[model samples]
Target: MGSEKPSLLKGTVDAVKACPREIFNFWLFFCTAVWSFSGVAKGFDEGNIASIVVMKSFKTRFVLDHETDDQYANTKGWIVAMATAGAVFGCLACVNLVQRLGRKNTLLVFTLVYIAGIFGQTFSSGSLSGLYASRFIAGLGIGTTTVIPSIYLTEIAPRSIRGLITLQYACCQQLGVVFGFFFNYGITKHNAGTQLQWQLPTALQLIPAVIWGVGLLFTPESPRYLLSKNKRTEALKVLCDLRNLPEDHPYIQEEFAGIEWQLNAEIEAVSGASVWDLTKETFTVTENRRRFVLMFLCHMFGQWSGANAITQYSPTIFGYLGIAGEESRFLATGLYGIVKFVSVLIFSIFIIDFIGRRRSLITGICLQIVTLTYVGAYLGVTNKMSTADIEASSSATAASKASIVAIFLHAVAWSIGWFSIPYLVSAEVFPIRIRSLNVSILMAFHWAFYFGCSRAMPSLLAATHRFGAFAFFASICTCSLIYVFFALPETAGRSLESMDRLFERPWYTVRQVAYPTAADLADGGLGDVERKITDEDLNKVTEVRIESQTSKNH
Candidate 1:
């Protein structure tokens, strides 16, 4: 009876240790999806149509009320630009803070900042100073949200579904954009008062921000951050919780050990022991520098792809398509947002791995080139020709509708390609220690370009015709595509440890990491022949080396 009891207890322990890894992954996915929704809220409202629409409302609510004598009319653009400026500061501040405070707490701070900003918006008087302050405060929140979510998601998610989870962050941002447009439109359609129309949209964002703050308070810190802090037991607990496995499970043990091994291995190269040093790659190892440069290039390429301009000025772009009236423009913007959300959601689920990162990015850029070229041609021809000729050649409605379609297609290409790739890459490629700082700088460029492209668009569109503006964007896409082809690595299905191994080789370039098709995942796939390290057996060499040394000594 005693022997039987021991056997039964052992069996139960083994079963607990064998919880499916996929369940942990799914839980991480769920948590990430929830956290992501908050980050997207600001973009949906501030970056897309909401800011512009609110500015336009200032004309009726404040400018005319002051008898047009006040310069509040002229200050609307500055008010709108204020958020971007605040974001710049917020982004820079986060670089040090994210690592110092930790991912979960840093994110919670952002939600609070956002909630405070939203509360301020309710009291805004449409004065130049008031609007500027509010926008700047909101911008800080926006900047923090943009960069922190990527850092958190990357740290917590598994390698197998990293791209999907990272891209899910991007997708949620787009979905938020769509919701903001609808919310603004719905609010205005019922009552166009400043309080109802503009204030409500800004205020509504706080609901999600509050929810995120509370949720993150209860959430575990990144296991990587835990390890970096030398809280090994806590790190293991996080890993087990995040992986949905018992602490004793073999694969869980392997991942935890691998993370520890890499951290210890790198620390051995460094003289000091501090989290700040870790964030800076203070040891100056080759793998560390490679990861830093890759993230830098990924962000540089992400911005150069014209993604921000599309996101920040979709309504304006639709207006350039010749849609007159505010409602018409907002409707078009709504449709563009919807297409972006759907495209990202679809690709992340079905094609992120299959299409591979490099190919999808190139495909996206190529599509942008094609669509922008056609739109530019049409606009250029119309501008150069006589009004009579344009009218005779095509109806205004037809031309406008065609332009909208082209822009929508451009959004579609981006959501699947450039829009999601940078965040995905930033999250996946870096070492755990420096993930936050790296993603912060990367998204800084992203938001910086976002601010630049957005702030510049109104004036640029005024100066250059639609054809000229789009031509510049098309040119950017061309250069970015070429760069991505040469620089981006595939990273599909590669474990974090295996990816580190690639960095160890010293001879590989970005092209080597591009995604292979379904054929690659097949039994005889080219990738298998080229790089066939099994996920379960990566650290076998360490054991082999130890055994061989023992045999020789004996």
Candidate 2:
């Protein structure tokens, strides 16, 4: 087990098999799923926006006709991308909320902003001003939606199944996609020419926000967060409840010890540092800077991959590929959403931990490269895809059918590769001391690029004739491929505390090899099999670190 990059899932898989019933239980799953529910509204908004924009009621209300095609694209881009622009602000605001209010409370308070934003938008009949303001307001609430949930899950999760739990946040986002696409299609189909067609879909976001708020009332504060506040007894009780283990049990003691070690490591870094000092440590420290760069490229390249273009403008993209009717476009978009949801669910549950993080990303990226290239070449050879209603062919041509398949394939590749990988990787890889600041900064970039992609998608397609845009996305995917292969270390089965060791090796070769490649040792301290530390050693650290901090204060 102490050999080369040991089979990625062996640590988790063995743990699951050995204690399937005892370790993984209903309580743990329940708490994780409730927070994951927050993603539904985000997904619905993202998927629903593009579909709703093409609705007859929406077009009528917005008076979408413009003097030029470029004018029309710009207007639509602003409408869809505005929420993300607000999201950038939300990310900036989240650190203060999470720091002062705690993770659960921050989410609870923001649900109202999200709900208020949705309420304002649903009722915005003919006012472009109102619609834009609503989108931005909702964006404020939505920004915290993803960042906090992933942080909470990773913090509370048992080491063995942490990846599975954290990825659930992404899984639920797809579930939202399913609801968003299908709901828009259902409403548009039933309502037809009525204003309810757009209003109902727009208002559907409130349901998830309400559910997440109520659930937050019952959810526990992150045990790690509690430890950070020096609530030792409270932190232990929370850990016991979360792990479903006795307070003094070896597993519980070691798990608590690992967190203390990380906390101590954090204290050692700044040692009574203030906010400004912490911010400086974020940049001045080599590891922190390296993680920051990884985050920048993680999102920037991801947005350029063109998958988001497909997600935000699938109806438009399909229409360009020669799909001919409003009904058909909506149907195709709805189905595309389903494919992404199913792919994420299957892979997160069955495959992600098994293949390891880097491999899953690599496999998905390869699929994206192949599919994007084919779609680009097909559009080039045909030179005929359009957003306008072209006459429906008597029968689907082979080339068009293949392009449709290629687009769906592209969605699948996106679902598996870039969809959740960036968030999951970002959530698990950083030290907890600066995790919130880093995550906020990372997601600010996430939404910033998201805003850029959504805002530019229409114009990019319009300017590039759809074909060149696809080619450009393929090129970006190629760069992400190289980055993942060279930069990201495998994170599967590692405890959060041990992530530092993964980056301890030189930057250039991080992806080439992992430290403590042995699966058992990968847990850093919690490894049940061949663990290097004893239960007493864990208890000793727990006691000594607290006393050391106390004595220093005196």
Candidate 3:
């Protein structure tokens, strides 16, 4: 029996050693998807609200029937924009709670909070104020959920497929959006004038939150977080389990050492630093500041890409495009949601790592610019023709069809590049010590920008008309393309621990830096990078200390 046990153990080890990279990566991806369910909850709200806003039952319940068209539009914008405002507060609040409670626990707490918000919305009646408050509460949960999952996924994912794994956040979010749209469509079709039309769709938000909270019990806490808390033995064991390797394995050893080295360097630099001091260092350090700027711009431009304007007001946009009838508009919106979901899935799974980050972003933005501009021109001509009393002309119908096609094309292009890249890049850009803080701040800015766009879009449309509104969005896309071309680095396959070296250069003069191969990782290639980063960080700490002492003496 003893002899047989030894032989079995040896065979199992050999089999693990011979396992293919693709199989291993797929397992990791599966694990990532389980944690990314929080995104689905947020996406559900995003898609559901947009659809609900156009429902006759929703407007009637809110007493929008007594309001003018302008008042109705403004009220609708406020309802949709309130969630983003809540998200900004949630993200800012998470900066402290995530670090204190740890990522997994914090997520659980937020999930409960989200459930409360959903209950409020599901049962809301009589007053729009109650609905607004409920949406804001949901937004808080979404904000924390959005930031935490990306951080967890980034920390756990293998370097070779980190981008692909992180992009799942976007994929799951779009999936949630698809579910929301279809759920609303079905409810609207059957329960059009009943309160159930909006109430049922609102209630569906609980499903993803419940699933995510239950799954959190089984999921492991992040190994990197363990290391940060000085639990080295626990960190190592978790790393081994995650990688499906033994403690003595070369990859396991290198990754653990890299984490320890980076953590040590951060401690040395900010040994006695307070939260305020770390915040200062985030801006004062050249590399950190550069990354901050890049992340912020990526997120800011992503919101301004006109996606919210189209997505949040899809029924309205379709109405403007001459698509008649409520049922047709809702069906079109559902189809639009599906196209977005599929396009993002395809790009995240098949093309993200293949094309590299910088090129993909630029190319995607360029396509957005073209599509938006074409849609604008068509709308401009059609609007002028309508004013001239040629309402049923063939050219008007043809232009309307072309504009709809352009909108679908825009979704495809946005999904491939702009939709997910900003979040992926933000998650990958920061160091372990300040990652939570940095990402929280960045996402807060993101939600703030989202709120701005969502709030102002209705007004912008009112002022600019359909054609001018698209032109404005096209102009933003153009600016975004130029900024990405010059500022964003290629971060597709790089190790998270290597971010210091990755951003060491000036932002303008960039080159493609490939990730270390298996052989390179095993042979201590990353060790050399870690050492350089350590030396530089320590030197900066020394210089700062000396300057501080001198000033004190003076």
Best by TM-score: 2
Clashes of each: 4, 0, 0
Candidate lDDT (C-alpha), each: 0.66, 0.78, 0.77
Look at candidate 3 and tell me the lDDT of residue 272: 79
Q: What CA RMSD would candidate 3 show?
A: 8.5
- Best-first order by TM-score: 2, 3, 1
* Candidate 2 runs further than 4 Å off: 1-13, 17-26, 232-264, 274-291, 384-396, 427-436, 483-554
Instruction: Choose 2 or 3, whichever is better by TM-score.
Output: 2
Q: Residue 7 error for model 3, in Å?
A: 39
Candidate 3: tens digits of C-alpha lDDT, residues 173-273? 88888888888888888888999989998898898888888988878888888888878799888777778788897788877877766666666655677
lDDT of 2 by residue, 1-554 (tens): 34444343565687667543555767778789898888886788888898887776687788875437777788888999999899889878887879888998888888888999999999987899999999999998888886788879888888777766777788788888788888887877788778888889888878888887888888899988999999989999988887788787888888898787766555554446687877798789877888778877988887888887788888887876788666788888889988988887887776765676788889989999998898888777667633332234423356677888998988888867787788777756666567656777777888899889989888887788778888988999998898888888776556543556556666668865643355423444343212323354446556767898899999
Error of 3 at 353 (Å): 3.2
- Per residue, candidate 1 scores C-alpha lDDT tens digits across 1-554 of 22111222343345445656454556676578677776676556554334444345655644534433234323434555667777888888887887799988887786677677767766667554666677688789888887778767877765544545666677777778787776666766665654566777667777767777777776788898899897989999988888888899887887787676555444433425465677657238787777766666666556655656566666656655666556666666677778877887787666655556777888888998998887887777676554455446666647756877888888878877877777667656665446545666666777776666656655554456657777887888887777677656676545555567656644346466454334333232222212333333335445554776799999
RMSD of 1: 9.0
Better of 1 and 3 by lDDT: 3
Q: What is the lDDT of residue 227 in candidate 1?
A: 94
lDDT, candidate 3, at 193: 90
